[model samples]
Target chain A: MPEKRQMHLGQQLTRAGRWSRAGITSGPAALWLGIFLALPLAAILAISFLTRGEYGGVELPFTFDSYKRLAGFGELGFDSLYPVVLGRSLALGMATAVLCLAAALPLAFFIARLSEKYKGAALTLVVIPFWTNLLIRTYAWQILFSPNRWLTVAAHSLGIGTAGEALYPGTLAVLTGMVCDFLPFMVLPLYASVEKMDWTLAEAAADLGADRWRVFRHALLPQIWPGLGAGFILVFLPATGQFVIPDLLGGAKTAMLGNVIQQQFASSRDWPFGSAIAAVALLLVLVGLAIFQRKGSKHEVLP
Target chain B: MKINTPLLNRHFCAVVFSAFLFAGAAQAEKSTLNLFIWSEYIDPQIVSAFEKQFDCKVNIDLYEDVDSMLAKIQGGGAGLYDVVVPSDNLVPVMMKQNLLAPLRHENIPNLKNLGEKFVSPAYDSKNRFTVAYQWGTVGLLARKTAGQPLPDSWACIFDPAKSAGSFMLIDSVRDQVGAALKYQGHSVNSIIPSELKAARDLCIAAKSRSVGFDGSVGVKNKILAKTAQVGIVYSGEGVRAMVDDTNTTYIIPKEGSVIWVDNLAVLAKAPHRDLAEKFLNFILDARIGAQLSAYTQFATPNQAARAFIKPLDLENHAIYPLPEVTDRLEFLNDLGFKLRLYDEVWTQIKTR
Candidate 1:
């Protein structure tokens, strides 16, 4: 009886140890998320409802005018600028994700196929762009895309643009910058999945009279969906709200959601309006992620 | 091998404890005054010299525009800063908001050193809250290329048919919109709905053909690099660019443009008010004032400092606009709550 009682106490100790261990491991992460993420989110939401002071900055006397303004119900009347800008931002984000995926897939596959000796070097090359500041890289693109530069000269020779004219402050330049900035994000995750791919399954599918496309679709894509989904989210979310890339490369011909929000916080000095726009943008992005996540999980199968 | 978690924890705790002690020691504070002003507006040497003279450390912060500075000050930065440099248009706004502290003339004896024009100016009469730092105009900086003659009229940029090659609009809301309003013979501070809308539409149209909006310095750089032909920029930058690159010329469009006086003022909640007052008086010293203007290439409003200023910089019409130019140029005034009209119109111009 004494032995049995001791064993029961030991099991209870182990139970308590499990709980404490989990707590110890997750405590910092929980604390960090609470402070940086949850606190700011709550503040922004609160600020969104407050009135903008005359000089700029939020004040008391809670108002929904910011939200109303964002919804195109301004003193000037309804205009499609805010809605159109938001739509354009979403479309641009999707385009960036698609472009990143298209570029990363072949690159990742090529790197995965390389022998062990060169694989690390090829992977490092993908990450080299990340070492430099994004702003500097974008500015470099401006120089590269500027007229008389060899790249622009070459592009002109290829009938891409007129001679002696800079190729930038245009959409093509913006897209190039966005893709260059986000390529590593897509490559690493997709490469992780590609490296661990089961090639034998593809061979077996092909041997069972499946075409090359069918074999890839049936065997390989499923194996890589998890990484692809993660990479897509990683690329798309940041691309959606990117201001600097468009500001530098796109020439500010039209404002994106990020630019509009930035103007409010910076020059406009209307923090309430900025917060309202941000809260709505956050909601839109979350909804987008939720939909994408649902679709991705449906396609995901355990390897 | 298994890791020793307890030992690692002990080491981390010890390091963190020491860090807290170091932080506490540092937080005991010093004779430091925080100066918030525009980027590239002040000479670093002037700041260092002030620090040496005062025997106090000066920590500097920079903002690109006045609105951002005002926003920061109002948004809890008031308690963090001692001195701020705001433009003429913002003085009344800051005063009304109670962001500025009353200037103690007794503390700054050099107030008498102000030029006739700067003394008891319209923005803050009797020198109650502000002192003039530097003054300049907003104008066009154009690259004189083979085909692109420099634009003399706002119409050259706004009137698409006579476009002076690819250009960039000034990114500042009031400045850009003001330029557009002036193009249509309207006030830079026009509150008329129709005039404002017309200006907004004009900017929106030009934005596409132009290389988008950029700061004055960026405009100067763009022209210097020959990526663009003309861009709206401030007189100081335009003048500086002219000095460096002869091919670049700064113009005040035939239609009048903005002339501004950037002033030095103390924040209401300044932690080191005495030190700030000292710094203000130090800047007013004739030699130091001249040095500041010469280094920055901005016009000095200090009468006593003019004799010490570099003759080239002092006489340049771009720095101190000619009387004719001054007759045409208007000072941007604080619009109070009505400034929201400009804000809304600016949003439309930027977005549309």
Candidate 2:
């Protein structure tokens, strides 16, 4: 009987060891993703299939009505309003990401080339704006872009906009806010790649008689491809769902997918519809990431 | 002897004792009453008074719009807040969804102080669900420039030719659409598809020539800052803005406007139902009602409270509209399933 008890104790110790190993490996991550991400996503997916109740709550009996509404079929006939908004949102997001990348590439290189002391200060400057609330910063932009402000006056003098008119509540202001808000996201990641880049390949390209553009295309671009991909994804995904900048700076004259989803949840009180929009947004982001990954893999054979 | 059982037992007893103490402390902390209300709608002094009288904590939470308030209560906040203030138009919606509890009228003897019209409102005809807290009108606020005439009609906003200068449209769906409806000689609460389409078109046309949409407070700020010459705003905001800057004046359009009443109601599954009922009763008291109106600059719906209100405030026509003007105003009713129609129309207007 003592031998049997000793064996049982040994088995319990083994079980405990296995559990501790698993806990060390993937426990916190699994628990976090399970609670915060997976559970909410599952709830949204389920809600997307449900029907809106008489007074805005969800009803149990499943329906595909929300998806149908999102597809532009509504009580007022086949309206393409939602589809138009979605297209506009995608265009705005792509524009913002492209603009950020264009600005960040040079800025990232400049910072990466700085002395260690200056490099820390430069990066700190890039992140300092984040310490202030985004809303307050956006409001500051509104004041600067007002009709009588110096910025608007300068724009008018430069023949960019009509005299005595605000330069905001329009596309220019919205784009400016989006680019300013997302530039850091692109800069930080691109700087990481640039800082680690080797200069020998670029020198070799120049030695091989390649021009400046060719040197960047073949040698420099490949070295920073990973960071570019990371920065692009970071900016593009959040920019796609950006509603606040457009709402505040662009005067809310038009609706984006984000704004529409928000309206469904807040103003319309239709959670099912909001969930459907969110589900579609998630799918679109996943597809985008997949395409990006495929293109990125092709560049992985770089020297 | 090897185990040290007495020492282990003492440690275990201490842990159990502390756990009990924590549980008791948590029970003692239950005196907090959670109140969900509109921002700047209550008097802080009155809240402190209620807290001191009851010897409990009053935790205030604010929401800017009715739909957001409804969303919170529906999305698991029903039991989190003891009391909520919803607009009259939303009372029926809350009632239908069972988000609000039936008020115990006997527990609230101060209900007799309310005006007869508000005592049995159309939204809560039996007075079963909600009690009126304050009432206001949605109207136009125009900056009184040196030479510009004050806008007395909705046409000043809807028609570019009639506008004195750049104006702002209200961002809220009901108020903006209702303004358009009233401009076109339709009821502010009209749910008819054809009428709503016309209103949407009018709003879209107005959007082209105006500074875009904003909340009433935003419009008031714009007017105060001289950024906008005119805008649709709530009467209370207009009155307050007029006080700050004597250059702005509010007018209920000759075509009429929406009269909205915000109500204080207990949640159906409120954790502190008795305390919430007591709060409702306390707020309904004549002096408290007068104080709330004085602080918020909104017209009280309590008849008895009028006796306690300052004569100057009672005489302010902007706060208390004339009977003729009040007759022109219409209250918005719950659209039920037709609400989707308004939502669709609003989306079209915004997109256009």
Candidate 3:
């Protein structure tokens, strides 16, 4: 009986030790997320309800004027400016994600099919652009696309653009910049999924009389959906809030949601309004993530 | 295992002694002054010379515009910086907001070297809170096309029919709206709703024809690259572009424009107030002032620095305008609450 009691006490101590170890390992990450993410988000929510001070600071009195202003109801009559900006941002983001996916799908598959040595080299080449600053790269594009440059001359000769006209500061230039900036984000994750794919399953689907498109849809796509979802989120979220690409390439003729929020904070000095915009953007992103997750889980339950 | 009390006490004593030593070293390295100013406005050589003379390190931070600078200062950056450079119009706004500290004239003996016109400027009477650093006028930078005459008035850019080739509007709210107001023969600082509405309409009409809004420096680059034929730019940027390419010219429109002055002032809650005052005095020195003007190619407000300036630069009308040009220039004033009218107008213009 005494021996049994000793073993039980030892087991209890071991269980407590395991619990303490787990707590110690996760403590720092939890603290980091609490301080950096959760606290700032809470602060933004609080500031969105506060009133703007006379000198561009926050005041104690709370009001919903910022939200009202965002909804097209300002001191002036109702206007569709803010809503238009939001819609434009959404369109830009969707276009960028779709373009990235289209370009990345084939490239990722090609990389996955390469020899082991070539695969590493190809991945490195894909990520090499990140070593240089994004601003410098964008400026390089401006130089290349200038009216007097050889590329523009070739484009003009090929009847792609008007004679003596630069191919930048337009929608085409903005789209080009956005796609180039985000392609690697899509390609990396998609490549991971493609590399782990089983060819036997695809062949079996084909042998079962499934056509090319049907095989991909029934067999290959479900396996890679997780990585595709991740890559889509990675590209879409940042592309929506991207300010520099549009400002530089689109010539600032139109303001995106990112630009509007930035102007409120940096130029207008309206913290409350900026916070309101940020809060709304965060809510939109969360809702999108929720819907995506629900769809992804439903796919997982299949087969 | 037996506890070693004496060994643990020795280890604790050694750690405490090292901590004290580190604290002393940190105290010894505390002689740094933080300066926040506009990008490309100050010469690096001048900053290094000041550091050498004072035997202390200087930390520099750059900003692109007045609004961003003010936002940073108001966002709990009060004590983080020792000095700031705010535009003349913003000096009054900052003063009213209690963002600037009063100047201790005794520490800045070089104030006497400033030109008579700038000594007691409207923004800070009797030089109470700020000192003039560099001043320039908003104007047009136009390329010299073969058969087209140079633009002489703001109407050339404001009127779509008269505007030639691809042009760029200034990306600043006050300057852009002011250009339209001046084109209509109204005050650049007009707060009247009807006048502002007319200005907004004019800008929207021009925007349809122009390339789009960009900073003065960006406009200068566009002119140099031959991407644009005309752009609304500051005098300094225009001068720089002309120096780069002789075919470009800077002109102050006949309809008049805004003259702006950037001032160096200490922050209200500065960590190094005395050091900041010394730095200001050093910058105001005659030779240093000339070097600064030469570097930035902007007009100097220092009377004593004239003798030190290069002969060609002193004679350049683009750098230092003639009396006739000066007569047509108006300084931007602090419009107080009326400033919101300009913001509203700018929003409408940008949205359209």
Q: Write the per-residue lDDT of candidate 3 for residues B1-352, one digit (tens) a residue.
A: 2478888988999999999999998866657789999899999999889888887889999999988899889888998999999999888878878989999999999999999999989879999999999999999999999999999988778876787678999998889999999999899989887888899899999987888789999999998977889999999999999999999999999989999999999999999999999998998999999999999999999999998999999999998999999998998886754655676576777777
Off by over 4 Å in 2: A1-24, B1-30
Docking class of 1: acceptable
- Candidate 3 per-residue C-alpha lDDT over A1-303 given as tens digits, one digit per residue, 9 for 90 to 100: 534534443465567666776679997898899999999999999999998766577887899988898887764457767777777887899899999999999999999999998999999999998999999988888888888789989988999778888888889889999999999999999999999988888999999999999888888888888889989999999999998988888788777888888787765667898899889888988998999899987655144
TM score of chain A per candidate: 0.92, 0.93, 0.92
* Residues B151-207, model 2: lDDT tens digits: 899989888778778899899998899989988899877878889888989999999
User: For candidate 3, what's the TM-score of chain A, rounded to 2 decimals?
Assistant: 0.92
What does DockQ give for each predicted structure? 0.46, 0.71, 0.40
TM of each candidate vs. truth: 0.91, 0.94, 0.92
- The deviation in Å at residue B5 for candidate 2 is 11
Record all residue pairs in model 3 with backbone atoms less than 3 Å apart, i.e. clashing: none
CA error at residue A79 for candidate 1, angstroms: 0.7
Better of 1 and 3 by TM-score: 3
Specify the CAPRI tier of model 3.
acceptable
